[model samples]
Target: MIGGILVLAAMLLTGTLTFWQQVERALADNAYTFANSYLDMAVTLAGVLMVLRGLVYVLRMQRELRNFKDDTWSCLELLIHGLRDDVRSIRRHLPIMLGGLLLLGLLSRLQLILGGVGFNDGWAELILVGIGVLMVYAFFRYRLQVHVRPRLEALEAVRRELAGDSLKPDDL
Candidate 1:
């Protein structure tokens, strides 16, 4: 709110950009840089998270082996417990992740609405801009999920296997 106002004030004071010029530049920036950077960051971060998830599983498995080399049940129990913790962590953090998506949607909509300033003077136009933003967000959400799905499936598989056959994996 205040931050947005301050940014606009800075732009005006600098005399380097009129509102329309800034809008055009912002459109180009968003089209070329912001979305691409956001997507790249998302993919990279998801990969990092998956790697960390795998590490947690491996570390716990190793610790279980070290502690209960002779106790098969304890090893399985530890493995299952550790995997459950990871699943729980994901469940707990899911809302925050979705909130980030929602916030991004709102910010993008605000940008679009601001850009459309001279073109349409009605609040109805603002609502239309918001709808467009949601459409864009939906596309982003689908694409991101497509990329992240396999990693999630792999994690879920390990969790399910541990839960279903905890006693057997301990032998190997």
Candidate 2:
């Protein structure tokens, strides 16, 4: 917060000097030029810092993606082994939902072709359908990750260790 205040102060000071050049000799003629140059340098430096911050953000996101990949794979293995029932439940529901959506798509197309629906040919209808499908998929993913999958994986891990066929350190 202090750094932000300093940056704001520097910017405001520069702006005031630039706009009110006649109020002070330090902001007149070559003195003004020098001060203005310094302000430009400060602004450029700030921009460079922002770019560096963006690079750091990207680096952190990349690291997170790698970690998520490892975790997701481990969880998937556990789900397959220990939570067959839950996985089967998801698999059963997902296909039916997908099929229903697909049927709606066909119906929409047919309506457009036959002039049976007002929105049959419009891009808006198609976009709405696309968004709806995406929302459904997102919900499914959330449920799999947070609701049914974690417990299943934990149980599977415990079962494996009990059977003396435990996972390697790298697997965990």
Candidate 3:
């Protein structure tokens, strides 16, 4: 999925560059306006794709959660596993998201500097700052999880003891 997204983004970028070149060659009266419109469409499409991807991920997670057995200990274990997976997923994607945002910001700034209608500096800065905030938020959540997991495991241990079951190590 990530590969497909990257490929599509690259294709859109290549097409945009090609179109800009053609517009430059033709020197049409509304070339910049048309180019800007096309760029906007491409960016909008990318945004929509990202939102859809996130929605799908959330739905899938919900479905998986629904499948677990309806026992407290099992549910707790599932939650611990889910948190670990969530952290891993975030860690894997954070860099890619950051890089993509930075690239987008750079492209927008370049377009502005080159006298083309493009995303304003404020918008780009806002996006970068938003990503930074999200990064920080994810980091804190991960720290909380790190601190919380052991306590959860201990609770699981106590539960097992009360149930006269031997404590077992988690496979996570």
Candidate 4:
């Protein structure tokens, strides 16, 4: 869902910028040209940063999952299995999401680079950027909810199991 939102934002931003550039070219306005370029640069930079951040998060999650299996707790053992499965799911989907975002960012950057497009500030742009921000937030939530929490639960379960306590599914 977050991936879908990011892709949508990328598409909207790219289209808006391209159309705005065409309109600017038609008018041949010299005003605010530098500001427009900077804005475009900022958006591109933000998107790239998001991709890098996501990659880092995925790497960190993988490392944690690796450590999880080595823990001695019986509950952790169960958790390790579930976490492994979760990590696998994340690994499968994350690269595709990153690739799509990267492609969108690249295409947007290309438009700015080759077309010398002018970007004016508008409410629509703000909304789209906000959506992009929300998508990032959603991704973070997914990582925590799907990956981190499960691993932590597994570890806790292992601890309980080692302590000779039975675990409920809710305990997990």
In every candidate, how many clashes are there? 0, 0, 0, 4
lDDT against the true structure, per candidate, is 0.51, 0.53, 0.57, 0.56
lDDT by residue for model 3 (61-132), tens: 675578565776666666656656555655666456545655655554565557745556446564655576
- Which clashing pairs does model 3 show? none
TM values, all candidates: 0.38, 0.37, 0.41, 0.37
Question: Which candidate do you rate higher for lDDT, 1 or 2?
Answer: 2
Q: What's the lDDT for residue 3 in model 2?
A: 68
RMSD of 4: 12.7
Q: Where does candidate 1 have its weakest 10-residue lDDT segment?
A: 33-42
Per-residue CA lDDT of model 2 for 55-160, tens digit only, reads 4445544554455456655644534543465466456855565555545555545545565444433445545656766786677678878976887777667657
The Cα RMSD in angstroms, rounded to one decimal, for candidate 2 relative to the true structure is: 20.4
Positional deviation of 155 in candidate 1, in angstroms? 19
Q: Which is superior by TM-score, 1 or 4?
A: 1
* lDDT of each residue in 1-172, candidate 1, tens digit only: 4564455455434433333344455467756433223333333344444455555555666676686665655555565566456555554554465456445544544554566634333435435545654675566456445644554565556656756766575677
Stretches off by above 4 angstroms in model 2 are 1-82, 115-123, 164-172
TM-score of candidate 2 relative to the true fold: 0.37
* TM-score sort, best first: 3, 1, 2, 4
